[model samples]
Target: MQKNILFLVTGMTPQIITETLYALAVDSENSDKWVPTEIHVLTTAKGKIQIRSRLFNDGIFEQFLKDFHLLNMRFDDSTVHVISHQGKELEDLKTLDDNELAANETCRLIKLFTEDDNSKLHVSIAGGRKTMGFYAGYALSLYGRAQDSMSHVLVSEEFEFASNFYYPTPYEHYVGKYNSQERLNAQHAKVFLANIPFVRLRHALPDTHPLKMDGYQFSDVVEQINQSNQNLSLEIDFTHKYIRVNRGEQVNIPPRELAMLMWFADNKVKGKSGIKAPTGKAKGENSVAENQIIEELTADYLKHYDDLKGSETSIVVNKEFFDSTKSKLKKHLEKKLGVELAARILPKQNGRSMPFYLPIESEYITIKDNFKDRLVSIQ
Candidate 1:
C-alpha cells in the first residue's frame, strides 16, 4: 500500500521521465515492478517550460497515459519544480555558479522527498547536466532507504535523441531520428532501465542526525558518513581521560571513570575475561580469576592517581570501590554513547547471576598507553 513517487532530474529533454516511467510500469512484465502514483521533475525554469509545452500543455503526457490505459496519473505545474538561484527561478544553468545552484537544489529536493515516510521514491538521473545527474544520484545515496531506488534510462541509439520519440506507443508510431533523414518505428526501439548501485549510508546516521536538520549542507553530510565508516577504535587518552569513539569527537571522562573503563578495555585487548569468578561462586571467597582482575585494575587505577594525584598520595582499592565504580562507569558510558554503542563497550548484563563483560572484540580495540610512560600499554 506504499505510495510510489517518481523523482526525475531533467534538462531540456523531459522525454526521460516518460521513458523511465514506461519501463518501470508498462514495458516490464514483472508484476513487482513499481508503478508511481505521482511524478515530480527537478529542472531549470527553461527546462520546466519545455516540459510544460511538450508534455502537459500539448497533451503529450496525458496521451501517453491514455495509450497505456493508465488512470489517475498525478502531474501538474506544481509538481515541476524549477531550480532557483538566490530565491529566483533560473532561466538556465549556464555558468559555474548556476551549476552549483543546480546541485544544491537537486540535493534539497531529493532530501525532502526521501524524508517522507509514506512514499517510496524512484529517482531517475538519466537526464539533466552531467553534474546534475551526479548530484541527484549522490543525494539519493546519502538519504535513500531500503525502499528507495536510483536508476538511469537507456533508449536505443536510433531513438535516444529523436525529437519525435518519447516512449514506445501501444500501437505502431513512427519517429524520426535526430539530425537524420531516416524515420523509424518507435515500437522497434528498445528501452531499458539500469539500476545504479549505491552505498546507502542512511543507516549510519541516527534519527536525530544533523543531516535531517534543515539548511545542512550536502558536503557536511558526506564527511560525517565517511568518518563513521573508518575502523572502530578507542584512543583512551589517560592523561586527558577521554575516549575518541569511532574517529568522532572525543568523549571526556573523569580520571576515576576512565580507570574503570580502561580496566575493561585493557582486559578485552588482552583476551582476559571480565568475569572475576565462575558462575554460582561462594559469597566471600576471592576466586583466582576475580583476584587477577582486581590486581590489574588496582595497578591501572594507581598509575592514574600517582601521575595526576602525586605519587605520594595513596588510594585504597577494595570490593566496595570496585563494585560501585564498575556500575558508575557502565552508566556513564551508556549515557554518553547512547544504548547501542555503549553495549559495544560494556555489554548488557545477560543473567541474574552472570557477570557483565566487554563484548567488543579484541581486533576492534586498541589500548594506547601514551600518558608519559606512567601507565601499562596494550595495543
Candidate 2:
C-alpha cells in the first residue's frame, strides 16, 4: 500500500497547514488531488502552541474536515514535531545555534520519511521563517526520491496573512474585522499549489554513506557530499605506515599489505607499465625476464616492509603472498574509502592474466620518507 505523507515546516502562522490541506484535498481546482494518509509538521515549541490552540482547541481543523467531508487523514498532537537540541525543545529560532538545530531536525525528519519505501513524501515550504523553509527544501532535495514532491502554497493577496482566515469554506463563511470592512467571504479565496522543481542528488550518495545512518547533522551531510566531488589524492607516510586521503584522515592497513600498496604506487610514479605477477618458481622454472621482475618486486616489497617494522626479518614475498596482499589491500581501501574512490586508486589489471598497475594519476600520489616541520623566520 502507498502511504502519502504531507510534511511541512511552520513558524507563528499555523494557518498554512489548513490552507495547504485545502489546496491538496478540498479545492476543486486541484483535479488531481493528493489526499495525504498522514500529516506531519516540524516547528518550534512556540509554533506548536499556536497550532494546538488555533487548529485543534478552536476546532478549525475538525471543522475544515467536516465541511469538506474528507476522511482517514491521521494528524494530531503527536504529528506536530518540535525542533530540539541538546535534549530540549527550542522555543524559537532566535539564535544561530537554534537555527542550526532546526536545520538538523528538518534533515532528520526528511531522512526518516524517505527511508520508508512505501511512503511518498510531499514537502511544503510555504510556512515558517525563511531559513527554516530553506532547510526543509534543501533536506528534501538531499533525501527525496522519485516518488517525493515539494511545493509552496500560493494564497490570494487579500486572504494571505489575514488574521481571521484559515481556508476557503464550501458555504458562505465571512471573516475579517468590520471597521471599514464589508466582510470578505472565505469561499472566494484562491489557493494555488506551486510545485517546486529540485535537483535530485539522492542517488549520488553511496549506499553506506553516513547520511543513511542516524545522528548525522545537516552540516555534516553537506560537508560529506561536498568532499565526494573533490579530486582524489593520496599522501603516504612511510614513518607512520598509513595513507592520508585528500589530506583528511589516516588509513592504516597491515604492514605487508601497506608495503604491497607502496610498491604499486612507486611503480606508477616511475612511469612503469603493468608488471606481471610472479610465478613463484626457481630460476630455471620461470623465464629470465619473469625471474628478474619477481626479484625486483620482492626486493621493493621487503624494503618497504623492513622500514615499516623498523627492522628486517625473515619474510618471503612469494606469488601467493603477493596475490593475497593485493586482495587484502583492495578490501581495506574499499572499506576505509568508498567503492568509487577505492577503485580509482587500487591497482587494476588490463585483461585476464595480465600485469597490474595503479590506476590513479601519478600527480595525485605523494610519498614522503619522513615528516618534517618547517620554521619560517620573520624579517
Candidate 3:
C-alpha cells in the first residue's frame, strides 16, 4: 500500500496544520485532493504544547476528521516532533543556534521519511519561522523523490492569523468576542493550498553521499551539494603516487595502476583515442594489430612506471598484467572517489574491440608541472 505522509512545521500557531489538512482533503477548491495516510510535525516545545491543547484537548483535529469523514489516518503525540538541540527541547527559536537546530531537525525528519520508498511526503511550510520553512523546503528539494511534494497553505486574509480560526468549519460556526464582533460564516472562508516547485537534487546525491546519513547538518548538505555541482578535476601527484580529486583528499593509487591512469591521461591530453585491451595470444594466435597495441601500451606504461619508481624495472606488461591493473585501478578509484566521479577519470570501453578512453574532458585533467617537467627530462 502507498503511504501518503503530510509533514508540517509549526510555531505558536497550530491552526496551520488543520488549515493545511482541510485544504488537502476537504477544500472544494482543491480539485486534486490528497488525504494523508499519516501526519508528522516538527515544532518547538511551546508549539508542541499549543498543538496538544488546541488540536487534541480541544478535539479540533478529531472534529475535522469526523466532519470530513476521514478514516485510517494516523496522527498522535509520537508524530509531533519537538525541535531539540543537545538533548534539550527548544522552547523557542530565540538564538541563531536554535534556528540551526530547527533546520537540522527538519532535514533529519525529511530525510527519514524520503528514505521509505513506500511513503509519499507532502511537506507544508506555512506555519513555522521563515528559516524553518526554508529549511523544510530545501531539505525536501535535496531528498524528495517523484512522489514527494511541498506547499504553503493560504488562508483568507480575515482568518489568516485569527486566533479563533483553525480551519473553515463544515457548519455555521462563529468565533469572536461577543460584543463588537463581526459575524462571519466559517463555511464561506477560503483556504488555498499553493504548491511549491523546487529543483529535485536527490538523483545528484548518490546513496554513499554524506547527505544520506543521519545527523548531517543543513550546512554540510549544502556544502556537499555545492561540491558535487562544481567542475570535477583530477590531479596526479607523481611524487606521492596518489591522485587528488577536485583538490580534495589524496587517494593512494598503486604504482602499476598509476601508470595505467597516466597512460590514459597522457593520451587524453595529447588528443589521442583510447587503446584497446590486449588479446591474449593462446597457442601463438595473436593478430598483428593486437601485438602492435600491446607493444605501444607496454612502452608507454613502462615509461611512466620507471619515472614513478625513479629507476628502470623489469615489469612486463602482458595481457594478464594489463587486465588486472585496469580492473584494480577501476575498483580502487570507485572505492575512493565513488562511482559517479570514478567514471569521469576511468578509461571506459565503448564496445567489444573498441578503444577504452577517459570519459572526463582533457581540460579538467592536470599533471603537475614539476612532475611533467621531470617526466619530460627523463624521456
lDDT of each: 0.75, 0.82, 0.82
TM-score of 3: 0.75
For model 2 the TM-score comes to 0.78
lDDT of 2 at 226: 66
> lDDT tens digits, residues 1-379, model 3?
9999999999999999999999998888789999999999999999999999999999999998999899999988999999887788889998988888888888888999998889999999998889889999999998999889999999887766555788898789876522436766677789989999989978885666566766668876676446556788888766678888888878899888998898888777778788777776523667888777667767878878877776655555667877788889977876666555676678888898898898777888877634555332221
Backbone collisions counted per model: 0, 0, 0
- Expressed as tens digits, the lDDT of each residue in 87-128 for candidate 1 is 899887789888777777777888888877998998999988
In candidate 1, list every pair of residues with a backbone clash: none
What is the total number of backbone clashes in candidate 1? Answer: 0
Off by over 4 Å in 2: 177-182, 229-233, 254-257, 264-379
Per-residue lDDT over 1-379 for candidate 2, one digit per residue giving the tens place of the 0 to 100 score? 8899999999999999999998888788888788999999999899999999999999999998899888898889999999987778888899988888889889999999999899999999999999999999999988999989999998898777566789988889888833536578888999999989998878886665565667778987776556667788887776678888878778987888888787777777777786677775642476777767777777767766776775564555557767788888877876666555677778889886898888777888888765322111101
True-structure lDDT of candidate 3: 0.82
* Best by the TM-score measure: 2
